[model samples]
Target: MNLLWLAVMILALSIGIFLFSLRWIRRWIREDIQRRQAASGKLNAIFEWAERGRQDSLRGLVLPGADLRGADLGPGQEGEPGADLSYSNLRGANLRSVNLRNTNLEGTNLEKANLRGANLKGANLRNANLKRADLTSANLRDADLRGADLKGADLWLTSYNSGTRWPDGFKPPMEAIRMEEE
Candidate 1:
């Protein structure tokens, strides 16, 4: 009878321990997920604030070398304001090696911006002013550049696939063509 009691106690203890451990693990995972979500929300808020400042004609809004992948920087739609960087002065900004895929840059002034090795795949740059911008070795695959001004811009070794659209009658440099071939 004593042995039987001891066995039953041991089994109950083991079950209690297992249940507690499982509950603790689940709590830890939930807390971790909440923490990550908070961080993401903070980052998005900062981006939105910066966009607002830029829209208010605040010059030199520096966001160079920022990881802005999948960020919506387009004009507002359906009463919701998106990030519109149009007419914003971004001269001499360091945007090197950043992912700007699918970003909107219509009519934005990017004069003398350092966009070396930046990935601009599928980005909309219609009517954007890129005068004297340093685009050395940048990836512009499938980027739309209709009506964009590229006067005095350096296109050295820039890569553009077949889907890339240039301004009307604009000719790509020899290096760009060679990069596409390779």
Candidate 2:
């Protein structure tokens, strides 16, 4: 009689553990599904906002490390090139320490932006409004700045190579500038 009772207790304990484990597994699955749903909703919103180029309203809405490469920001004119910005407004945006090699920035407004320590090698800045932009320690090697407004733009400690193209008859400011050997 005692042996039978012990066996029954053991079976009950095993069943209890199994039931608890199943509940835990279900909870984990439910949480995972919820997380995926939330992520999907956020992605949908990002796409909607990017498609419209809603710059002024994207201050806090743009996700971190957003991928906006090859996105067309707006209409381009003769001598101006268009490109994808990857959701960076860059209006007075601090691009210091950022590498933007070969990225298109045609007709983007970069007025008063801080581009210190930025690398714009082979990037297109055609017709970009860069008035009063701080480009200290920036690398503009091989970048196309045709028709870009550089009035009062700081080129302190900036690097320029022979491949870098400047606006018609314009040269990089001669203040603490470096020229790369061809």
Candidate 3:
């Protein structure tokens, strides 16, 4: 009789542990799914905003901390490809830690914009007005800056790899060069 009682208690404990573990696993899975869904929703919103900005020239548009990785912002012209963000005004906008890899920003007016810690790898900034913009610690690796005016822009600790393209006769700050060395 005592043996039978001991076996029942052991079985109950095992079942209880199994149930607890199952609940915990399910909860973790649900949370992961929720997080992915939220990320997707945020990405969709950013895409919509970019599209709207393209149509309206992004005048006075503000999209701080947007994750636009692999997004196309070139012109939608017939037979021409790329996400078009040309002729847009983004003055004083906060874009801290945002990802704008491979984005097209030709002729965009970004005067006084705050792009601190942003990733602009491989972006095209030909003729873009970036006067007084804050690019502290931003990554501009392989970015094309032909004709882009960056006068008075804060490039402290900014990263620029060897593949980075600059305007004619343009010189990068010492701090940016140091970051590349590190």
TM-score winner: 3
- Minimum summed lDDT over a 10-residue window in model 2 is located at 56-65
User: How close is each model in CA RMSD to the real structure?
Assistant: 13.7, 12.5, 12.1
Put down candidate 1 lDDT per residue, 14-113, tens digits, no spaces: 9999999999999999998886676567457646665664253222234432334334343333333334455655566667775556556677777788
RMSD of 2: 12.5
lDDT of each residue in 135-182, candidate 2, tens digit only: 888888888999888899999888888888899989767773657764
Off by over 4 Å in 3: 1-83, 178-182
Predicted structure 3: lDDT: 0.72
Task: State the C-alpha lDDT per candidate.
Answer: 0.70, 0.67, 0.72
Which model scores highest in lDDT?
Answer: 3
lDDT of 3 by residue, 95-130 (tens): 677666666777777788878877777778888888
Question: What TM-score does each of the candidates earn?
Answer: 0.55, 0.53, 0.57
